[model samples]
Target: MKKITLSLSMLALILSIGMNEASAQKIKINTKGIGAAEKGLKAATFSDADAAKLAGEAVAWMDANNPVAGPNDPYTKRLNKIFGKHKNEGGLALNYKVYKVKDINAFACADGSVRVFSSLMDIMSDEELLGIIGHEIGHVANKDSRDAVRSAYKREALMDAASSQSGVVNTLTESQLGKFANALLDSKYNRKQESEADDYSYTFMKSHNYKVTALASAFQKFADMEKASGDNRTKTEKMMSSHPESAVRAAKILEKAKKDGLAAL
Candidate 1:
């Protein structure tokens, strides 16, 4: 009995050490300190291969700066379960990580990395979360992620990063990675791309037999939250600034729901 007790204690100590080591590796990024490599860098076009390379660099930089929740974390486990159920149609293999951040945001990269903010998960239902995730996947399927990467990095810098792999393309330095990472955070999708992604998400839900109405509900929820902010940011201004307005998107989704006779429409 004493030997068995000793073994159990040893196992517990090992697990505690492992947990501490993992926690030590997690970092908090000072978003303000990170700046773009070049101001007003002219947008450049890139091949699919080049976009993939940039995506790798950006992911590395982000992983270093952001505190990523581990697989053992409940949030990470939940996200994995939800994401795992979906079979992505895009060519890129999708992988997800949960960032322990307060901001309510999520993003997908050209390399098919989806990082979800913990705050977003806190407020959204599983179905609503699926809708938002579907929208992000749509961006990847439509190659919008690749385009975003291209717009963030200069042609010369991207080419350099790509070539560095084979000694043919110039390689990206750690500093360069930081700049690209910052640019990615600041990257904006045009209205056209946003609309396209929305359409893709709708189709994805319809195909998967998920609740179509949930999409509308998610948008309405965001709209309500924005309104509650009680700031000068009107719904229209907010929509036009980047993504479509929540009310407008919610209306569009409801229209589709009604046409399909989905769930109490």
Candidate 2:
């Protein structure tokens, strides 16, 4: 009886230690490198509730400070309608808004918020716009923005900058947030990440029955713009800086479109 009791106590202690170890192990995300993993883990550390709260605050700041104009513009209405059409396709409650900025760029935040720029609309057709929107949506669905925020927090440049003096995790004013946004926009994503987002966008648009060729065409247009406007600062910068070279991006999209049997828009 004494031997049996001792055996049972040992077994219980071992089980307790195993459970504690399991609980203490950090959840690792399947990202590329240590840096990427760190970013992903930081983003994943936020509960769904906390992510939603932060997203809401960020959008509110954008809405109040950078109120998008041309709300009544036909193009604006059309863009909004298209976003509404496929908002729920990814099993997330997605919201869309346009920014009045002239820079030809668009981005999505975590919690399914998409922001499109007005200048991009001036250049892209409706179908092309869909492609851009789809790409931005992919980022949101993939939680790239959250990971990006985490990466920013880890960087000394971002941390020590005046804009980040308040800390990247804290609530920021519109101006402060704008500075952060600009920095992010200027940053180039790794080739692998860009490829993944491209894949996501292609799959998403095809699943939704959109003309995937529009993505290719959109890239072609940007490439042309880059070539034509050599010295013009606004045009060249808009066409060049914020994205990968249009030719490269377009070629990737074309290959995917061929595999997916994408028809022209």
- lDDT for every model? 0.57, 0.50
Give the lDDT of residue 28 in candidate 2: 20
Error of 2 at 101 (Å): 2.7
Question: What's model 1's lDDT at 183?
Answer: 58
TM-score between candidate 2 and the true structure: 0.67
Residue 207 of model 2, lDDT score? 80
Clashes of each: 3, 0
- Alpha-carbon runs more than 4 Å astray in model 1: 1-45, 155-177, 232-240
Per-residue lDDT of model 1, residues 222-257, tens digit only: 677666765675322233334566678779888977
- Tens digits of per-residue lDDT, candidate 2, 1-265, equal 0000000000011100000011111112111111211222233254554445444554555555563657787656978777767777588777777766534556565566666656667777887777766666655566655555444434322334543444333433344444443333223344444555666767876887888887777667766766677777442243234345567878878887777666532
Task: Give each prediction's root-mean-square deviation over alpha carbons.
Answer: 13.2, 18.8
Q: State the TM-score for model 1.
A: 0.73
